[model samples]
Target: MNDLPAFLLRKADEYNAPSFIPADPICVPHSFSKKQDIEIAGFFAAIFAWGNRTTIIGKTKELMALMGNSPHNFILHHKEKERERLLGFKHRTFTATDLLWFVQVLQQHYQRYDSLETAFFPTPVKAQEHAVKHGLIRLQQTFFSTPGAPMRTRKHLSSPERNSGCKRLNMFLRWMVRHDNSGVDFGLWKNIAPADLIMPIDLHVARVAKRFGLMERKLPDWQAAEELTAYFRTIDPEDPVRFDFALFGLGVLEKF
Candidate 1:
């Protein structure tokens, strides 16, 4: 237990290989080249990234197909008739209505910005505490800022204001921000720093964190994410979320 961070670091190195990308929702973004395409694909994939991993990957691929496998182009220029393909799409609580609102809001957002990072971090990403969490809240405010956005769509996005862990958005930020030789994370964003990123606390990560004595919180809420990230930051403040691969692989793959 004393050497837990070292062991987790080893596991992170072991599991963060290029080979791990194919079976992951991250693959949806890796399939594309353009930055906008990667960002768009990764955003939708992260939103659908709950429940069974296999099912998540499958449904995400279906979503890409609906966008004609060109997410940025589809979001910007798809004709009204083409949106019919998004009908009947369902993944857990994310229904067709939710998807439709996302498309519309994203389309509206892209009208002014070239990437989701700009939409999320409209202001300069200062080195303030809870900057990432504040950005998530701002993203929600901006997403629903315009008219015609369904109230239900707001439920799909999480915010620190609601005390949500915001696992999906944090994970999406990891995909966009964390840069490493490891081929898993896309590292496409330049605004947000990896140091400011929060942990994406789900059941698996929570279980591993508690077992390793890294987390004391009873529930995987926003507070737990902060506590866990704080611990990891003590060890590696500049790139704490890389421990995500270790916790995920240990919990889901190795049963640690």
Candidate 2:
């Protein structure tokens, strides 16, 4: 409707090419075929998707190797001796303790639900705004509810209720939920509508959004993610988060 929307659409098209997948953490999940493997790999990759991109990919590969490149199987049935291989793994502040706890939680979760989506949105979806926010809250609760979960590991799994931007989790959601002819996104989860997805507002995206008059918030928090996603919806109600590539690309690649 507006020039801003059109311009962003153009940028999204420019950036959302098939070739972009290889350089991203999403590639880790893409390399796997099984649904559970994809979910497990993507979740691990996303949680560690901070700091440098090269470092992120490297660590993700290392972690995957430790899992024997079979993430779901590894998480569900890792022997005690096999888990010792993960003892020295560390990505930023996410250390071996956090990784082991995640495996434990995933085991508990898979025992109950068929997919991770159910663990997040266990209740029926009512007609409501911020249902995704509610899902994230429930997911946090479920994650920490695992037996012997250390309070220290809670920071890795963000809570939107706490005003966190939750950039990485939202990015993982994008990888799982948004599909296009371009094939960058997976569109694996059918329960969550694409319209409900929010922008993963990292620093690069936030800077680009501000430069384009898409956001006024100084902090890239939950409020900023909502504001930015609402603005993007005006441009494309069916898939507002498509513009996430545009925002992130404009900032990171074009240096806008």
Q: Could you tell me the TM-score of candidate 2?
A: 0.96
Taken over the whole model, the C-alpha lDDT of each candidate is 0.89, 0.86
Maximum-lDDT candidate? 1
Per-residue lDDT tens digits for candidate 2, residues 175-203, read 88788899888888877778888899999
Residue 154 accuracy (lDDT) in model 1: 86
The lowest-lDDT stretch of 10 consecutive residues in candidate 1 is 118-127
Predicted candidate 1 versus true structure: per-residue lDDT over 20-97, tens digit per residue: 898889988899999999999899889999988889889999999989898999999988899999998999989999
